[model samples]
Target: MNVHITLAHPEPTSFNGSLTYRAETYFKRAGNNVTKTDLYASDFDPVERGAHYKDRSNKDVFIPLGEQRAAWKNGTTPEDVRSEIDNLRNADLVILQFPLWWHGPPAILKGWFDRTFPSGGVYTSRMRYDEGYFKGKRAMLSVTTGAPEEAFGPGARGGDPATMLWPLHYSLHYLGFEVLHPFLAHGVQGHGYSYEDHGKAECRLAQKLDSWEDRLAGVWNEAAQSFPGWPDWDHRGQPLS
Candidate 1:
């Protein structure tokens, strides 16, 4: 299978980056074609503005969606975005590896969603949800958290994992991917941030890496997380009774 891993951590030696590397190696060892994009290492611009669009559809106002539509139509989509899109186009499974910062993804990864999935090129009103362009593709999030696993759940201190991850999972669903249950590694404190003994923390993290590899072996056969599709919603997007 073709796999694409997108790493959104700033430090290449970070635990999040290690997960990305492990995934790449796993796929390659299995004889699958693996590709990767390290957003920080590549210095990917996460901001979307008029600067990205060379040939503007409207010079007076810079509407992001409008410019995207025009660019896709005129074949003037920014080269970097186009390249990222091409990577997605070739992948059977797309893994997003990132740390949970401020209870959400890093700005760079979010911007990848903004730039890579062009308006007219990837989605339209009629082409979203179950009918989105990437209908047959699969996507998963491998998230790392600083708090312990016990701190996350409904009514927990770190906030519920389901609630924290909903926006991202829904966004992938919007693009028509079969979104998998996220793989979460908690207690991922960096130096000087440990809640427990440093030696114990290191040992736990090492075990988590092994667990990650084991999970990947059967990732394809796992059922995707349940999500409301077109059939579940009315024309107004409310849940059907």
Candidate 2:
């Protein structure tokens, strides 16, 4: 399969960085084409402001969604946003590799969603949800967390993984990706806060890398995470009665 890996961490030597590298190497070795979008290395600008739209529809009033729609129609999309869109268009499977910061994706990745997913270009009101632009493609997250596994549960201190991940997963569903179960690596503390010796952490990380490879081997056969779509919603956007 053609795969695209988007890395959000600033440091290329970080755990999240290693995960993206491993994914690229594993897939390519398996004879699949892989593309890497290292957001930091590429110096991706995360903030979306009025300046991005040079051909603004209303220069005085900067409406984000309106500007995006206009930019897409005029083919005046910023080079960075255009590049990401192109990569996603060609990929069969898209993997987002990042560390969980404050229970969500980094500013870079979130801004990626904000900029790359042009309102009129990638999706429309009627063409969203299950019927989104990337209907046939697959997407999943490979995340790292600083907390231990025991800390995450329905009512744990680290917060429920499922609940924390819902907004992002739902966003993918909105764009028509067949979202898969996220691959999480817990107990991944940074240098100063590391709970284990350096050697032990390296060993654990190596083992996790192996597990990631195994997951990829069966990715195609895996069931996607189910989400409610138009069929399940009413005129008021509530669940159908």
Candidate 3:
């Protein structure tokens, strides 16, 4: 199967990078084709602005969605966004690898969501949720945190992973991919930021990498996270059950 991995971390040698590398190796070793997009390395611009569109629907104002719709309709989408969308289209599985900064994904990755998923192209009023363009594909997040796993969850210092990741997961679900449970690596600090002995930190992180590999082996068979689809929502977009 074709697999696409998008890495959003800046440091190539960081643990976040390791998770991405490990995933690529795992998929490739299994004889699957792997495609990687290192957002930083490629210098992906995450900001949405009128600069990207030359023939604007309204030059006097910068309406992000309006320009996106026009671009999709006119085949004038920025080359980078078009390329990324094509990569997504050709993949069976997509892995989003990033570090949790300020309780969210990096700005670049967020921008990728903004630009790549074009209006009228990937989704329309009638093509969202269960009917999204990537309906048959799968997507998952490989996220790392500097705090210990114990520090997360309800009433925890680090905040609940579910709450932190809901927006991203929902966005993927919006695009029609089956969203898998995230592979979370907690206590993932650099040598300088580590609270424990450097050796102990290294040992723990290494183990997390092992766990990630094991998880990936069963990723395809793992059940997807539950989200409200079209059938589960009413005309007013309220949950039916």
Q: Which stretches of candidate 3 lie over 4 Å from their true place?
A: 191-193
lDDT, model 1: 0.91
**TM-score, every prediction:** 0.97, 0.97, 0.97
Give, for candidate 2, the lowest lDDT window spanning 10 residues.
189-198
Give the per-residue lDDT digits (tens) of candidate 2, residues 134-241.
999999998889988888989999999999999989999999999999999988877312467878877887898889889999998899999999999998899998
Tell me the tens digit of each residue's lDDT in model 1 across 86-176: 9999999999999999999999999988888888899999899889889999999999999989899998899998999999999999999
lDDT of 3 at 30: 98
Model 3, position 53: C-alpha lDDT score = 97
| Error of model 3, residue 147, in angstroms | 0.6
Stretches of candidate 1 off by over 4 Å are 191-193
Tens digits of per-residue lDDT, candidate 3, 87-193, equal 99999999999989999999999999988998899999989888989998999999988888889998889999999999999999999999999999888877313
lDDT of each candidate versus the true structure:
0.91, 0.90, 0.91
Error of 2 at 12 (Å): 0.5
